[model samples]
Target chain A: MDKGRIFAYLITIIACTLYLLPLYTMVNVSLKSPEDLIWGPVAPARRLYFNSYLQAWEKISEPFFNSIKMTVPATLISTFLGSISGLGFYRAKFKYKDLLLFLIVLGFYVPPQAVLIPLVKFLADIGLYSTIAGLVLTHVAYGMPITTLLFKNYYESIPKEILDSAEVDGASLTTLYRSILLPLSLPGFAVVSIFQFTNIWNEFLFALVLGRGRASQLVTVAIANLKGTTLAAWNVQMAGAVIGAIPVAIFYIFATKLVIKGLMAGAIKG
Target chain B: MARYGNLQIFLFILPATVLVGIFVYAFSAWNVSISLTDWRGLVTSIRFVGLENYLKLINDPIAQKALINTFLLAVTFIPLTMLIGLITAILLCLELKGTSIFRTIFLLPLSFSFVISATMWTWMFSPEQGTINSLLRLLHLDFLCQPWITSTEQSLWCILLVYIWQFSGYVTIIYYSGIRSIPQEHIEAAEIDGASRFNIYRHIIVPQLKGETIGVLTILLFYALRVFDLVYLLTGGGPALSSEVLATYMYRMTFNQNLFAYGASIGTVIFIIALAIMIPFLLLSRRR
Candidate 1:
């Protein structure tokens, strides 16, 4: 009721409205036909046109599959590898430990563009270039820093006494990790998964350059290509945009808390 | 006593280390090498041309334009987004009703791909029958109706506007989390001392949120420096290279014009600039 509250409320409404504008435009554009799109503010010839959605769906389905093939395995592998390394760093004392940790952390800062050409050549030499496996490998490499950081922080938060107790029980490292560490780290896993899922789902450049063929192209590249091909069809492009964005939106809707937590953790710790 | 665990740590780290080493560090080295050579088209001949490519980059008009546009975009977007983000975060930290809903709604933009967001905005900014133009017409502000993305003068600002809209919420979530983590006792004690809300925030909260501010600013700076996706999708850095940023311009040089070495040089410059800015910020934050 006070001016402060009123001002906050007004700002909140404006911010939310600005945030929602593009989504509103996407939905409205998707509903309109090509003619309506070009005519500008004209009355729609019909309530809805399903053709654009159909076309977008048909065009992007293959790339959607390609994205899944590349993203899922890469996410799983990166999370698994990151967790193991995090546990090792936390539990085991090692020479060059600081250096290794620093190197892993440094991965977060290296610009992807810097490595694009060499990665292309490396993959090409190994006959993996333009393949889903190559795409997945590149993603995993790029993804490790944050994933390792997340798991390391999560493991650090765990009590050292628990691991000592497990050691006292004569449990081997592998057994302890499998039974105790992994189970205790489920929230961290979820957090990492959400981060990796959104990141890989939205990734564009590697998918664009590395996955050149229809066989390996991901949804982002597919949608980008659609933009080029459907230059005049605004409705179709909007439909494609909506389709390309849906998976990420769905993932965020389900795991919003975990994603936000993961992001905050990374930001704070970094 | 735990010295032998070094081997264990090495084994555990091997996969990630090797992957990053090969793809990141090694690849970066290769990118730098390629930039120094005259590699053309799909041709594999890579002959070192000393600093010729770098010299060319300094003089190339379009490359200069791209560098200017990139810095312009960063300078414009980073501070504006941070201010918006700080305000939103402060509001959310008030623990108002529906705060959870507000959190979720605000962070939703982070989940959407920049490509999709940019494409959708492009349509909304279209010259003919675009939503922006239609709205202007409705409000009898016919003078405001213009091609938002196509005009050379307006395109970069238009792109910056979209970037701000897409990222403000993301930065808000970061700041919100940061603000929440600030101990409540500080605020409460300040209040008990008869401190006004603004004074409490200014004197207490802002200083406490320094780490979060640095982290958010650094991420935004990196993003602004290397921005490509939205510009690529929205304008392809054109209506005459008006909206071109360094990354998109690099892509254009190599892919569009087959000036591979020139593009690589531009990319190398971008990397160096990013490093120069980030390393100092990181060191300063670490010192703090």
Candidate 2:
């Protein structure tokens, strides 16, 4: 029994160590000076330099704001659209319901790379390329399927009797959704919000290809550019990474339970 | 009775459906069209090139390398991630104290952007002053040190290691949920029947977790094929395209090399590969 306990502890420690390796490296890199970075491999600096954080801050502030602009609206729009569609699919009898649902889910499998060039061209022709609105619209379209699927599943889990009762009381669709279904499904909304937020925030390829200038560049693109141009500025790059990652990390930490529950809920339903 | 409800449903769903159809499906078709044309550098004067782009792709060395590397990376990543995930899930399911804390710690990586994760890992594998080599020296194992991200032989492996570190936690959570769904009665019955822990796991727990396993495997496989951020950040398919995956190679072809049509051809190939794998799986799961 004692041996088994030790073994379990050992496994846990190893797992935790593996998990922390990248983070540990990031912290170490963030504390080093540019001179140290160029001179050394990836070792700790002679002393911790805090100026890198400032440099990274100045370099990324615009892109950071751009990211926020893109991610927040995208998350809100996607989640709202998803919830409404999910409710529609769940509550109302629709023509070609199965086909519609399948189409929504099919969006999940379409590799973003598969449509990159044409999307770029299409958006460029419409004056949406290199614009924040364009990026948000694209994100919304991409995010809808998963978001809708999540909400639809969650709505399905709600006992049909409650919805029926609301209908019998002459509650209209909007009223019923706002007063009952929405409140009851707040947790699902929170889950979808977090997922969409993380996805939009972390998205790089589209942002890189679409958002060319500093005016619309996202944090991921900023960080990538920073890394490429400021090779010597390891600390600054790490600082940029830390700053770029902080908001999503904080969001996930706060809603970890909700996120896990949401994933399981969606998976089981699917 | 249902007239108002139907109107409401249409109103609620039409916007999202239309957007998805126009952007996703329409764009996908457009992608196919571009792949067939001689479009280059901003889609000007697109001329139908038939299967010329694809035929060129079949013989292109970089594309061949990319196809092979993508398969290799997925092959390495899926099993390794599944193994680590399964182990961690099983361990966590043992009802150990502080499991929640462990879960949180493990999940911390998933919260960070893939760019951040890849950047951090790249720093760790830095040849000169990286923590890995320092730790190795500290433990008197100096011989194992090498330039992890830059070396041809090691670049792909390094990327795979980073992926495993970042994603194993996610799969662990999935498996944990699956394990939790198993009824307690079954385990107790096996225990009462003098079945060993291994026996109960092999016979009961594994069988019960099949659905979750399938789900995780399919998701992981899809993710592996589409992997971009880590490979892009870590090596940029470096050391002479040794680490190039389909996504990265396609990006290079379009943006870096200005081979828009060829890139689209590659993207079309990727779509076909993904559909080839996913369609059967979807059908099978639907049948079940």
Candidate 3:
């Protein structure tokens, strides 16, 4: 009934429409039949159609699985490594400990271009160039800085007195972490794993240079190539993009709280 | 506890120290060395050129355009995103019904990969079959149907538009949570003093969102510096390298042309600039 409330609604509606327009076009066109192609992207699909999905799946499936094969191992290995290292940085006392952690965390901001040439050469020298394993290694290595920071931040949130008491009991490092830190770590694991999974899944540059071969190609690269392969077939291209986006999209939707938590924890100072 | 020792810390951090040390830091130093060479191809062709590439890069027209475009994108993008994000956050805090649903919808785009965004937006910006031009025609506004990515003039701005679309929602989310976290006492007290809502916000609320703005700007500046995929896929820095930023142009020089040293120089430029901006910010965060 008020003037400002009406304006607020109008603003919200306009913003949402702009955000959703491209998504609507992609979905609408991907579901159109060849005969319905004449209607253009402005219209909704004339009828339900699934052939584009099938065709797109056929082209992108192998690389989709390749993404999975690489991302899963990289996420697990990186998160596990980051946890212990986070604990190390949290508990360690040394002359240059802060300086060392500062250097490690600073790597998170290094432009990938700065490391690309040598990463490719390093992988090639080890005979792992253009391999899925090489990509997994790249992801894990790149994944270290943030994962360590996130878990270190997470572990620090556990009160010092709780860990102090555990230390008073004569428990060793491994035992304290096993019995105490791991249980308290479930939320941290959720946030860190989601962060790593979405990052590695969506990554393009590393996959482009390091995993260009068919045997190790990532889904992002495949979807990009799908455009060139099906150059005129907009339907197949949109469908392939939808498929490429599904995993990360699902994570953002279903685990939004954790995703935002990860984004904040990764980017902002805690 | 001292029994745990420095050895314990080093042992626990071994994997990260080694992996990040070699993969991130050492590789960066190696990249810097390669920039000092003229190793276009063949291992035997390698020769130390020593800043030849940097001198040439300074003179290069395309690199100059890219530097200008980067400054253009950053100068436009950062402020616009923050302004829009701040406004959206304020509107969401108005406590209308179903605000959570609106928040969720706004964030949906952030989930998409740039590859997906490129694919989708390329379709949306297609000259003949695009959503914008088509919708324009439907409204009988054919005069407004301008060439988007194909026109050299429009190409850079189009990339800027997409960058804003993908990122503003992220800034909004950070700001929304930030606004919610501000204690209610100040606003309540301001209202009791007969201050208008706008005045209350202008004087009391906006000033306190500094941390959120800094955090959001750090992320946005990083994207502005390293943006490649969308520009690479959407326009391929095309219509005469009109939309070329340093990343895509550097990629082409190195990978496509095999001008390894030239590209390495460009990469170093990006890295050095990033460090210059980021180091102070990192120190600030550490001090906090």
DockQ of each: 0.55, 0.60, 0.73
DockQ of candidate 2 against the true complex = 0.60
lDDT of each: 0.80, 0.83, 0.87
Better of 1 and 2 by TM-score: 2
The lowest-lDDT stretch of 10 consecutive residues in candidate 1 chain A is: A37-46
Candidate 1 iRMSD, 1 decimal: 2.5
Cα lDDT tens digits, model 2, B160-221, are: 98888887887899998888889999999999999988899899998888788777876786
Give native contacts recovered, as a fraction, per prediction.
Answer: 0.54, 0.58, 0.70
> Which structure is stronger by lDDT: 1 or 3?
3
Isolated chain B TM-score per model: 0.92, 0.95, 0.95
The best candidate by TM-score is: 3
Candidates sorted on lDDT, descending? 3, 2, 1
Q: For candidate 3, lDDT tens digit of each residue in A141-246?
A: 9888889989998988888898988877777777777899999999999899999999899988988999878899999999989774545478888888888989
TM-score of candidate 2 to 2 decimals: 0.95
Candidate 1 accuracy as lDDT? 0.80
lDDT of 3 by residue, B1-288 (tens): 434667777888888889889988899999999999998855576889888999999999999998888789888989998888888888889987878878877788888888888888887888898999999999999999979999999998998888888888888889999889999998899999999978988998889988887889878877876778888888888988999988888899989998888888999998997788788977876575
Q: Which pairs of residues collide in model 3?
A: none
RMSD of each: 2.4, 2.1, 1.4
Tens-digit lDDT track of model 2 for A1-270: 678878998899888886887787787778877667754433557788899999999999999999998899999999999999888877767679878877777777788888888888888899999999999988999888888888888898889888887788888889878999988998888888888888789888888888898789889988888775645377888899999999988876787887677555544424
Candidate 1 lDDT over residue span B144-241, tens digit each: 78878889999999889888887887789888877888898999999999999999889998888888888787678767866888888888898898
- For each of the candidates, give the backbone clash count: 1, 4, 0
